[model samples]
Target: MSNQKTSDILISEVGPRDRLQSVSTTMPTAHKKQWIRDLAAAGLREIEVGSFVSHKLLPQMADTGEIVAFARTLPGVFVTALAPNLHGAQDAFQAGVQKITIPVSVSEPHSLANVNKTHAQMFEQVRQIIACRNAHYPAVLVEAGLSTVFGCTIQGVVEEDDVLRMAHTMAELGVDEVGLADTVGYATPLQVHRLFTRLKHDLGELAGSAHFHNTRGQGLANVLTALDAGVTTFDASLGGIGGCPYAPGASGNIVTEDLVYLLESMGLRTGVSIEKLLVARETLKQGLPNEPLYGFIPDAGVGKNFHYAGEKA
Candidate 1:
């Protein structure tokens, strides 16, 4: 089979959106641009460049359009953005983002609080957005990411059946894929394995990309569980610069450096350089002067004896 015919892991770097949103100090736009360029140059094929939410709402993402345009200049990279509503989607589409992921919370309380819409209203909105994107920007792929699929801080446990129903609903509404997010970082390896297995059986090809956060220190464990359950695509932040604004000291999403190192050590191909990934952390410091970044790889220093398997670019 051709390489194109084979399925491989698609790691969508979400540090710009997920990680940046929680921090108070807005990152420098130039530093953001250079960090994105460096990541793309280092071989990440897809990156979530920004979110189309209001500048008033998320000051960290005020330069979304500009960053999206800059990301487009790089070759062989799929530039993506998060569109919180139809207006955001339109802005992202105009910015030439090839893909837009619109988040819809599985937990109704989270949905109402985060986006000011109920689950039914959000699903209907996704339907309209899908129609709009299909008619106007046919090249763009819309993924309805069901956030808090595992558990919610405000809403307690989200039922697995509810998640599958949302996935099916999004698929029926014509979304390209349905992504599961472990918002608030409450997912464990057992839950990840069982939930992914259940979603695979129910959602089929539409189920993908386990989004994990290291809030409770189960990030890499959940990642491994998802891999065992046959999930390939993953959403991780660079430098582990993520946390819930409401939940303090919850800094970290499965660090891209650690994930790459784990994959390489297991003889899997991630196509990312561990050293370059660590070097990229310098941009984190520059972009976020006061922000404290977290990750074991940077703290542990990749062990004394280690070598990256990916071909250096």
Candidate 2:
């Protein structure tokens, strides 16, 4: 945990990739860099800068390599990117990312719909990614981003046993971590608690970040449950900007600013500056003024006499 505050929670900013990909208007590469820089300045230690997928599928992330290089120049920032297969993972590692996240959906239907791969094929890809990473850049961490661990939009009611089985399989395959994602916002607090608790029990330190969508407005509530279940790392977006393109009902991710407020107000340090986070939100606005951004903390302003327990801005 040398890269993070031991006493504080780690918030991984995913807006640059997750948010931009869902929109039609490609965010300017320069604007993306500016937004990422501002986010790092706001005290976010980890950020998923972009995804290393095909340009045909996601033109917005065409410049992920350049973005990764730019993000590396920032001090104290750990840059991560999404890689759907071995090729993407190799490209991401060669581009100099600190970590790579390869998503594998627990629900077979969702996996096929999202990545055009079955569970077996996706697991094989993960194995290849791990082998490639080990052979080339052993320092680069490879994480299994378990998507649709909750119920899936395409195939509803994903079983808990499937989630656990896949998580254990990822752990057995030598993934550095396994993150649970609520791909369609079908997860409840009790469900989140039960699932994450079981995952932690199964994988221990390998059970990683919690990613939730606010489609039903339960994103923050789910985060609370994950925290109680002993999850420290969380994946959130700037101004609440994210949703799965493959999942119809999926909507925005848990808003980073409000999540930080929730953690800091409870005296759990997040090492983020709420005031500076709002400034970063403004940077996002200026870059993509037409896009709608969501967050309550920015609208209501900081509470009267609010004191941040983390590092001061």
Identify the candidate with maximal lDDT.
2
lDDT of each: 0.82, 0.90
Residue ranges of candidate 1 with Cα displaced over 4 Å? 1-7, 244-251, 309-313
Model 2: per-residue Cα lDDT over 1-313, one tens digit each: 1276444789999999899888888888888899999999999999999999889989999999999999999999999999999899989999999999998999899888888999899989998999998898999998899999889878888899989999999999999999999988889999999999999999899999999999899999998999999999999999897887888888889999999998888778888888899889999998888999998999997787677775454
Off by over 4 Å in 2: 310-313
lDDT by residue (1-313, candidate 1, tens digit) is 0011122566788998888998788888999999998887667788999899988888989999999999999987888899988889989999999989998888898888888898778877887888889889998988888888888888888998888888888888898878888878889899899989988898788786788998888998998899999888888888886765543344578888888877766656767777777777887778887877777787887775566554342
In model 2, pairs of residues that clash are none
Q: Which candidate gets the maximum TM-score versus the true structure? A: 2
Superpose all Cα atoms of candidate 2 onto the true structure and report the RMSD in Å to 1 decimal. Answer: 1.6
> Model 1 misses residue 172 by how many Å?
0.6
Q: How many backbone clashes does candidate 2 have?
A: 0
